[model samples]
Target: MTTSYPAQFLAVAGTRPEVIKLAPVLMAFAERSAEAKAALGVTGQHRNLIDAALNLFGLTPAFDLNLMRPGQSPAEFMGRALVDLTTILQHHQPRPAALIVQGDTTTATAAAWTGFLSRLPVAHVEAGLRTRDRRQPFPEEINRRTIGLLADWHFAPTPRARDHLLAEGVASERVLVVGNTVVDALRWLQQRLTEADLPASARRVLDAGYRLVLVTAHRREAFGTPLRNVLLALRDLVMSFENVRILFPVHPNPAVQEATREHLAGVEQIQCVEPLNYRQFIAAMSRADLIVTDSGGVQEEASSLGVPTLVTRDQTERPEGVEVGLVRLVGTERRRIVAEAAALLGDSTRQTRPDRPLNLYGDGQAGRRIVAALLGDANPPPPFVPSIIPTNSSDECRYESTQDRCGFQWSGPRHSRH
Candidate 1:
């Protein structure tokens, strides 16, 4: 048997969110021939979850590292992935022209670093997102910052994200404000999904004339005390309102699973089940009256669907949704969560406002723009210009000099020509 390498771009994904965001870019590459096609490399940071997302997009990886293990630490995973990725880059026939990675994960950071060590040009997708506080999101903030320093091209998802890179002194020419590919993925999934595709647990709530509050909380920051507060708040909400029901798709993480089982297992009006596949999750989100989550991807998905959302975090990298009134940051405080959820549930008008201008994240053509940029076409797609600029909060680049607070010095011009 002979193995043929058809990949010009070696796109890598380790988690479900990475798979979702990268799927659009891979699809875009598929439309082209000869030097434009990409081959996927799965790091298996999230095993089953990554498989479900890959299946949803009809994608198969050219290489699978299968690195995930129960009770694995980020440091351990990074060490293993770095060695495996290096072997792939060195021995693969017709080495990939560029190494592509998405979002802020240990896998992405490791891959970007490996690419740099291998002297390969690295292109970062969904780049330039920052919460500014490294400890808040733990490791992810630092992982993305490291990638920013190493990547040759930064495919920023919004004007805000591009500005963050510029503030950090990254070359403006290297950063392109391509809209978020999550919107592209969401739009593609929504076209094929229907009400019947929703999980049975979700459908029962809607049929019973009860307002459904879909919940998802799995961030490392929300592991112990914060997660318990959120679960307690959900119990309070259900006990307080007769027409309210909760549907939480529990993450497979041991910390999250333990907390969920201890606080929410066998609780009345709350359906705690295993994680739903991408398609069923999309169907569930569409019919959800309100969403409470700490996942960044869910924030974008809920906002795009016009489903009112309450973010259970102190800060978010994706603040475009908050710039509009569609999303609110309630943090992990029990009282705050209950108050916000109650306020939205009590008012029927706040549930789903489909008429709101919710294209702040994207217009679903981000995949095409990314492909044009990667191919170095003569005419690249125009940059995604957001209609709504943030005013309520200070989202601009706050660095006073060429050197930022983090000690990264910018050598290029501050303003972008594009």
Candidate 2:
């Protein structure tokens, strides 16, 4: 009864988001039949953040590249990751059948390219996201596009994402619309989290009945002036409203730390604590009144929790939340951020409708579907089909007659093929 499985897949993760998104897929692989052996490779692009996420998910990387350096640029990281990943693919015993890279990080791009060069198939998870403008997200847009070119299999999160890949000439059979794995990660963590697990500052804000505004804005595009605008806006919001408390989990980048100290160090209402673990962050999101962030993952997580979010970017690759009125793009202007946050905070009636059924991003089964597809299952799990909910039309939502979930009846073509 002991069946051995070869190392058929090598999953690479380098950032916190990558680890969080990929954890469920890795876990699913373990749950599959013995032939579905998959291994993890860590690049240490986000060092402490990556380790925290891996520990939270109880995952250990088979190969730890440890390629991070102080204030390393994307180009530098790419060069180093490319060299090391190439060596691993070429020399490691039990050579993997394919390379798995999740999301659009420098590590993912480098690893995918290396896999292609080493004559291995590449699978791109969370693929086909696009902001159209390559420079807006500063390399992420470009990075994902490049991965799209090199990847043999594209695991898109939504139908829209699948369309993006198809329009770009990706073969129809090569793409599958698996819902985002973030929802899977959230579902797994929600069972283990409680209100008691929230950070002390967050708990105080909620217990005292003060509005808690969770803020996270650390992106390459928002380094200098844009970051300053966000910090100044937060400072202004807390100063203007006595009952509003800002809980910011600061990133450890030197530039971000320096700017945060310069602008928000002494602010009493704004608590600039160290970065939170994944569990703490999810707990905070569940209880937060409002969230302002420049992170794509936060957008997906907040939407799933039905939390209102203000994205501090001009463009977002994740537009599913925006379409459902759960999120708004406020850009990185000081006045705009303050104005939007003030409006949401001032109006107690403004809330994401609990019954709106905004599962546009996912329904927490993405991991199983992805694993089945990678293993070439003869009967793969059905691709995720999002309920069609129209923007600005609450009356359009209809409950499924047989199920407890809500969705609108759509007359358009469906893409439920596996």
Per-model lDDT: 0.85, 0.86
Clashes of 1: 0
Candidate 2 residues lying further than 4 Å off, grouped into runs, are: 1-6, 352-357, 388-418
lDDT (Cα, tens digit) per residue for candidate 2, span 1-418: 1222356788999999999999999989989747767888999999989898999999888879999999888999999999988878777667787899999999999999999999999999999999999897988999999999999999999877887898899999999999999999998999899777799989988888898999897898899999999999999999999999999999999889999999998899999999999999999988898999999999998887778899999999987677656789999989999999988888766644354435668878999999899888999989887653443454434212123222223344432110
Listed in order, each prediction's TM-score against the native is 0.91, 0.91
Which digits, one per residue and each the tens of the lDDT, describe model 1 over residues 1-418? 2345788789988999999999999989988766577999999999979998998899999989999998999999999999999888888667788999999999999999999999999999989999999987888999999999999999998877888898899999899988899999998887898767899999989999998889998899888899999999999999999998999999999999999889987788999989999999989888888899999999988877778899999999987777556689999999999999888888754333454334667778888898899899899878875542222322332211223323222232342101
Candidate 1 residues lying further than 4 Å off, grouped into runs, are 1-4, 349-352, 355-357, 388-418
Worst 10 residues of 2 by lDDT: 398-407
The residue pairs in collision within model 1 are: none
> Native-vs-model 1 lDDT?
0.85
Best by lDDT: 2
